[model samples]
Target chain A: EPEVTQTPSHQVTQMGQEVILRCVPISNHLYFYWYRQILGQKVEFLVSFYNNEISEKSEIFDDQFSVERPDGSNFTLKIRSTKLEDSAMYFCASSEAGTGHGYTFGSGTRLTVV
Target chain B: AQSVTQLDSQVPVFEEAPVELRCNYSSSVSVYLFWYVQYPNQGLQLLLKYLSGSTLVESINGFEAEFNKSQTSFHLRKPSVHISDTAEYFCAVGAAGGYNKLIFGAGTRLAVHP
Candidate 1:
């Protein structure tokens, strides 16, 4: 079965540096999403994307966070300036028909900011 | 907003033993329920989901979940589990209406021992 793929399985960056997490969702899927989980915490929704625009975002997705579909296949989450709290496992997911359909998730990128 | 709660942080069961992971949600309106499994250092994988209909949904694997509207619960069950079933499980909820966004639980870590 086809699955989502993410690059840089682990990322380590300085606290003030900028970082981008990349994901290649399933080829035929139309909707994409980003979620984050702090160590031992529940996964939190960051943002949802469709048609190259953000459909919805959570309070955690503040000024520092931005998502872009730079290419037809790549969906990315960029943090302008990373904070210690930004360290978490960032997951990318996609669904074929809509949200009603179950989502397929990538292995996730573990971001560690020091 | 929708939220999910997983009561147990960890569960240890012997091989071939039955297991149940409880989940509850708080939502004023109807919602979709889901169970996801995560292997160590990996991403979330869809195990099962409850959208509508029979109120009982199952995965290709032997796992199943029953959606209880009044109790606002969707508990996952497996008649017997294998050592390979050891993983972290998460329960999630999404509003059933348009713009459905997912909210996840803290997760339950299942340890299958010989």
Candidate 2:
């Protein structure tokens, strides 16, 4: 089974620093997404990307956050200035096209801001 | 807009016992329902989904869910669960359009005791 790969399984950064989380979605998938799960909270959608642009984003995804497909396969989420509240498990997911096919989520990167 | 509700926050069951996790959703438009599992220190894995056709869907690992459009529920069930089934289960909903984004519930932790 093909899998979505994310780098830096765990990351610890100082507050107010810049951090970039990387992900390699399934090769054939066209729709990519970034979600975050705060401890004991529901997984929240951050942004969705397709056709090289952002399709949708939530209110939580403010000016501090941005997503990019820097390469054909690499989809990344960058936080310009991280805050202590930014600590969470960030997940990368991809789907072939529609919601019917469901999605594959990466193991997630645990971002801890000190 | 779509939202998912997982009624139980945690469920404890003995090994080989049957278990059920209740999920409900509210969507103004048609939506796709999905169940994902997350084991300790692992990423979210697709358990099953309901898009169309038969309302009932099953996963290879002995889990099944019935989509009740009238009630807007998609509850997961396992006749006999093992300790390996211990994990956090999430119910999600995605709208049926080009730009589909998933909305996840807070999650239900299933603890299978030996």
Candidate 3:
């Protein structure tokens, strides 16, 4: 089965530093998304990207968070200034068409902003 | 808007015992429901999803869920469970639009003890 890929399985960054989480979605996927889960909390949607631009984003995705599909394969989420609360397992997902078929998710990048 | 709620935070069951994970969703418009499973230290995996069908959806791992429009619920069930089934399960809701984002519920940890 096709799979979404995420690099830097675990990342440790100092608070107020910049961090970029990278993801390589399925080659044919049209919709991409980023979500994060804090310790013991529900996974929250951060942002969605389609057609080389952001389609939707949740309240959690403030100015500090930005997503980019710089290339055909790599989709990256950059945190301009990391905060301790930003520590969580970040997930990258992709869908072929619509969400009706659900999404294929990557193994995730555990970001620890200390 | 769409939202999901998973009723139980944790459920402990013996191997071979039946288990049910309750999920409810709220959306002003028709929505799709999904169940995602996360093994320890792993990313979320799509277990099953319910779009528009017989109101019943089944995963390859012997798990099933029924969508009830009236109750606005999509509870997952398994007649028997194994230790390998122990994991955190998340319920998600997505609006019916062409490409909408998903809202995930607080996960339910299912522990199948031997």
Candidate 4:
């Protein structure tokens, strides 16, 4: 089956450094999303993208965070000056339709800020 | 906003035994329900989903979930499980409208032993 692909299975960075996470959603998918899971916690929605712009975002998605569909196929999340609390597993997901349908998720990038 | 609650943190059962993972959600509007499974070090995979029509949905792996509107529940079940079924299962809720973000539960870990 087709899948969403994410680069950098793990990343470790200084607390104040900038980090960019990349994802290639399924070829036919129209909606993209980013979610994060802190250790032993519930998965939290960060942002949703469609038609090359952000459709919605959660409170956790603040000024420090930004998402872009840099190219036609690649979706990227950039965190400027990451904080220690930013350490978590970031998952990229895509769906052909919307919430009424199921989503396909990438393995996830484990971001660890020191 | 929608919220999902997984009552059990962990459930241990021997191979060939039956199991159920409880899930409930609170939502003001119509919602879509889904169950996802995540194996160790892997991405989340859709187990099943309830969008419309029948309240019960089933996956190819013998897992099933019934969406109960009145009770606000979507509990996952399996009549017989295998060792390979061990994983963390998450229940999620999303708005019925197109392109809505998902709200996920903390997750329930199922450990199927031989």
Candidate 5:
């Protein structure tokens, strides 16, 4: 089975630094998404991407955060200025179009903002 | 808007014992129901989903969920669980529209003991 792939399984960064988390979704999948889970908290939606543009974003995805499908295969989430509260497990996911097919998720990138 | 509710924060069961994780959702529009699993130090994996045809869905592993439209619940059940089944389970809802942004519930941690 095809699975979404994410890079930098773990990352540690200083507060106010910039960070980029990368993911490679399933090739045929058109819908991409970014979600984050804080320690002992629920997983929260950050943004959703389709056709190379963000279709929807949550309040948590403020001016500090952005997502891009930089290349045909690479989907990335960038934090302009990270805060200590930004520490969480960030996950990337992908799903097909026009169907209720469940999504495939990548092994998350654990981001620790110090 | 949509919201998911996972009643149990944690469930501890002995090996080979049956288990049930309760999930309820509220949505203004028709939505898709999904169950995702996260094992130790890993990302979310789609366990199963309820799209349209059937109210009942099953995963490859010995797990099943029944979608109760009246009650707005999709509770996951496993007749007998193994240690390998120890993980966190999340219930989520996606509106039936273009953007598949998901609303997730606080996860239920399942701990299978020997």
Candidate 6:
């Protein structure tokens, strides 16, 4: 079965530094999303992308965060300035063309902001 | 906004024992429900989902979940778990619309003992 793949499984950065997490969703998937999980907290939605545009975002997805499908097959999330609180597991997910279809998630990129 | 609640934060069971992870959600309108599993240092993997049709859904790995609209629940179960099944499981809820942004529970860590 096809699975979502993410690059840089682990990242370490100093505070105020920039970081980019990359993912390649399933070949035929249409909708893409980014979510984060703090050490002991629930997984929270950050943003959703479709049609080369951001469809929606959460309050957690502030000015410092942005997502792009730089290429047809590559989706990325960039943090302009990383804060200590930004340390978490960032996950990328994609779903087929349906409102209620199940999504496939990547292995996740562990971001550590020191 | 939708929210998911996982009653038990951790569930301990012996190998070949049956186990259940309770999940509940709060949503006014109809929504899609999903269960995802995450092995250590990995991203969430789709276990099963309830979109339409029968409320009961089964995964290939002997895991199953039932969607109960009346109680707003979608609990996952496995008749016989293996050591390999030890992981973190998350339940999520999403609106049945274009975005399909998900709200996840805190997660339940299943520790299968030998």
Task: List the candidates' TM-scores in order.
Answer: 0.97, 0.98, 0.98, 0.98, 0.96, 0.96
Lowest lDDT 10-mer window, candidate 6 chain A?
Answer: A95-104
lDDT of 1: 0.92
Model 1 segments beyond 4 Å from truth? Answer: B97-99
Query: What does fnat come to for each candidate?
Result: 0.67, 0.78, 0.85, 0.98, 0.60, 0.82
Candidate 1 chain A lowest-lDDT run of ten:
A94-103
Question: Which runs in model 6 stand beyond 4 Å of their true positions?
Answer: none
User: Residues B1-98, candidate 3, lDDT per residue (tens digit)?
Assistant: 88898999999999999999999999999998999999998889999999896999999999999999999999999999999999999999999858
On residues A22-99, what C-alpha lDDT tens digit does candidate 6 reach at each position?
999998999999999999999999999999999999999999999999998999999999999999999999989765
lDDT of 6 by residue, B1-114 (tens): 788899999999999999999999999878999998999987788888888899999999999999998898999999999999999999998888665788899999999999
Q: How does chain A of every candidate compare to the true chain A by TM-score?
A: 0.98, 0.99, 0.98, 0.98, 0.97, 0.97
Interface root mean square deviation of every model, in Å? Answer: 1.4, 1.1, 0.8, 0.7, 1.8, 1.4
- Clash pairs detected, candidate 5: none
Question: What tens digits encode model 1's per-residue C-alpha lDDT throughout A1-114?
Answer: 999999889999999999999999999998899999999898999999999899999999999999999989999999999999999999999988765677899999999999
Give a tens-digit lDDT track for model 5, residues B46-73: 8998988889899999899999999999
- Alpha carbon lDDT at B76, candidate 4: 99
Compare candidates 5 and 6 on DockQ and give the better one: 6
Candidate 2 backbone collisions, by pair: none
Tell me which residue pairs clash in candidate 4: none
Off by over 4 Å in 4: none
DockQ of 1: 0.73
TM-score of the second chain, each candidate in turn, equals 0.96, 0.98, 0.98, 0.99, 0.98, 0.98
**CA displacement after TM-score superposition, residue A66 of candidate 5 (Å):** 1.2
Q: Encode model 5's per-residue lDDT on A19-106: one tens digit a residue.
A: 9999999999889999999999999999988877888899999999999888899999999999999999999999887326767889
Best by DockQ: 4
